[model samples]
Target: MRTATPSRAMRLAAVASQAYRRVFAASRLAPLLSRPNPVHRTGYDLDVVVRRIAHEAEDVVSLTLAPTDGYPLPAWLPGAHLDVFLPSGRQRQYSLCGNPNDRSVYRIAVRRMADGDGGSREIHDGLSEGDLLRVRGPRNAFSLVGTADAYLFVAGGIGITPILPMVRACHERGAPWRLVYLGRSRTSMPFLAELERHDGAVDIRPDDEYGPPDLAAILSHAPRGAAVCLCGPPPLMAPAQRIMRSVNPSGSLHAERFSPPTVAGGQPFAIHLRRSDITVEVGAAESALAAIRRALPDVTYSCRQGFCGTCRVRVLDGEVEHRDRLLTDTQRRDSMLVCVSRAAAGPLVLDL
Candidate 1:
């Protein structure tokens, strides 16, 4: 979620409302604060064979993969996703929907969007059952921290993939959980019938058949310590989050973005490569990933947002103004995500 900034009007109103107060903690107020970004992570490659394929929705395809060498399947927690190295070296993230406990095969759901740039559409239009693709990761950006007093799973369109396993986890752990699955229509929704098995625990809101789904009402049911996880377009998350805050509180609601944040050019920073001893300039026109690859063509990266952590390198010196939301506060102080983060000042050194 993007950070919120206080407007001048709010400032003026606060000044007028608290005009009689001797002192006030306005800076401590949320209106002045910006929401922090979620941490990024890395995953390893596990090249697998596409054992089977099934169409779940008009734009969605489900794939069953097997280890090419009969290696043990990557152990994944519920609500995990994997990044696939597609044809032409393009990387895309997909949510895992198969049973985590049953480790024989890994299942994933991919939706071809109308605005999708070739990659997803290719999965729908060209990928076959026998085709093999380089697959990496079974990672969880939206991991269940095992803390929530109750769980509320809200999903939209292809976002349903991640939530499915969460619902299953809730059931397995005997945790109090509810799912409000939203889709454009019945047939267009993948795994609808299967989810209906949890009839009382799940609510299916198809846009074609139902009145507008009320996020506020649904959020009201979220008790304290309730962890609300959402995966979908930016719009779907905003309203749901609004209700989450109005009813529950901030930080109680969590979200996962398959895409990275927009690249707003910050002040130029110098990058010093200790291993290579090369310094490169990165600005709005270039990223550390791009600059490093330019000097060192062999550098590999998948998700540039630093979530995949593929391009992570050691920080030998200098203050790195971390912009990517993927690094832990501790890790940020020690290392750097070269993909999105840059040095806060000039002459930054990296142990590349």
Candidate 2:
């Protein structure tokens, strides 16, 4: 009594089954399948659990996140930010400060902004270990180009979050890099101990002691062909940018801003929604997005600071006073990130 050999169709089916199982395995496909859909509009779609939370400095807390299913998290690079969905129904972006090579955990440090939009306050007071969080993006609007001969990193207070990983990358690659970490004081500065490990490469400037960083001297002394990566208050970055332009005209300078561009004495404007057949008045004190939301409540938006580009709308007519740092000059020709931008002239017609 001999057993019959399997047919060709049977063998092919077995192979296909194995392949399917392998592809759907926890390690291989979990991270890919867990990625948030870019077109989801509402932003946060992936769920993660807070594995640990520790204070990095005064008013600064670091959160380590892992996928709720215990699978590997999505891989990210230096200067990438994660949009953290808070329990208070607000989404805020925080830079991923941990090693980019670590796929199992994503770390982000948040500084309690005493006078912020309340997202930071929620993260500080509300979120805890074991809490589940909805998150989107390890998105990189400010990424290291890796083409420079040398690098200069300037971080102020919580701004150190994004630059920390970049410094590690520079160290691993043995690239010529210098870090200027500035804060109100040494005690307030997060990652001061970590940065001090690279003593020769870092300059910790506490404003109380140093008054302010000598932007002119720092830029002038920077090695030729160096790219300066700055993440800090606009007041600090604005001067550094000017000095960089004068000292090394050909050098590249990139900045990551945590705040929206200031609009001084903005004139009142109106928005005309073409498809919805509605008009909303944008008062001098309020943003266009706020006014539009009153009429169309379901409009998707996140990071009302204008950095996320989630509330962006196509403009059909009228001039725009584009104030967002996220858009390129070319993009401002027709589209506007309504979170910060307002009308330069009259009623701006939007596709809605």
Candidate 3:
């Protein structure tokens, strides 16, 4: 079963919600409207129930979710994710690990981080099949584009989730593709055996890729127009980024920031919304998106890492200092993900 994209009425509902929020800002209704509960407008929201669970690793659990009637599991293009609203009132997003082309059941592989704040543990112990959840979206920020070109996918640990689907997409189309997987061990890595069956070139660096399967050698074999996308731990990503940077421009490389870069130490900045046309100052302690969202609660966004394109806004004037992984050359030319990016020099005026 596949769910349809948001209807025209849904967008209208969002507009209505926005208007209601502004009009009721002085009344008690403002707080009610700003609640992070649910925005029924975009059918991107759904109700789901766990159908089955598999322990892929010590901490990872692969869950199969069933969609409610009229809200069937969406036909997600491979490399998409379903944003789940946890009971904790925070929305947690997970990549669709099942066959992206297969619409029968939506599957997601979740690794429980030792440092995770109970979300992982909930999937392990608290959640079970038949437990209904307010699930929203079969969203894909890491979408597959330019399939005609050669491809190189670099996955580190959980980063494999999005790439798995992309590989399948490329293979079915007979596009040339390779993989550079970095993990701590074969047992701990999810979908290890599945990748081996791909029959294409695969470089698995369990601890360090220091041996014959060095990333340098693997990258040397890349064909022209070969796009590279890396997802994994920060340590693996940094080195991978350096290698990709040496060969390809940022446009040729696609990445989803699993974690925010800790690069801090910039003076306070300001951003002016060209659409909303509101200029807000951002302190060093605050992110551009956090400052924008707090100042304008009507903005609905998901990932704050700029990995997800939900927080994207167009730039009308001034230069932007981009540190996000979601935008393309076209997107970068006009739009910026406020979640992770900040001003390079002067205030950036955006078209929200």
All candidates' TM-scores? 0.70, 0.78, 0.67
Q: What is the model-wide C-alpha lDDT for candidate 1?
A: 0.74
Cα distance off (Å), candidate 3, residue 254: 1.3
Q: After superposition, which runs of candidate 3 have C-alpha atoms over 4 Å from their true positions?
A: 1-42, 208-217, 239-241, 248-251, 263-265, 268-302, 307-338, 341-352
**lDDT tens digits, residue span 1-352, model 2:** 6654679668887678555534554465444453333222223256889999999999999999987655455666688888887886776788889997777789999999998767888999998899999998777777886899999888989999999999999999999999988899988999888877898999988999999777777777678888889898878776776788898777789888887545568788889999999999988878888889899866767766766787899999999998786878899999999988999887899998
Model 3 Cα lDDT, one tens digit per residue, 139-247: 5566676543788888878889888888888888888888888777777788877877876577777763344235555555567667777677776666665776575
TM-score between model 2 and native: 0.78
Which lDDT tens digits does candidate 1 get at residues 1-352? Answer: 6644678668786566444221222233321121111242233356678889998887788999887655346567777777888776767778889887665688998888788556788787777887888876666667775887788888888888888888998998899888988888888889987787798999889888886666787777776778888887656765765677777783388777555544566666678789997888877655777778778876766667667666778788898878665667887877877778877776688888
Screening candidate 2 with a backbone cut-off below 3 angstroms (N, C-alpha, C), the clashing residue pairs are: none
Task: Please identify model 1 stretches exceeding 4 Å from their true place.
Answer: 1-44, 239-242, 262-301, 311-320, 325-352
RMSD of 2: 7.7
Best-to-worst ranking by TM-score: 2, 1, 3
> Which stretch of 10 consecutive residues in model 2 shows the poorest summed lDDT?
35-44
Query: lDDT-based ranking, best first?
Result: 2, 1, 3
The collision pairs in model 3 are 274-350
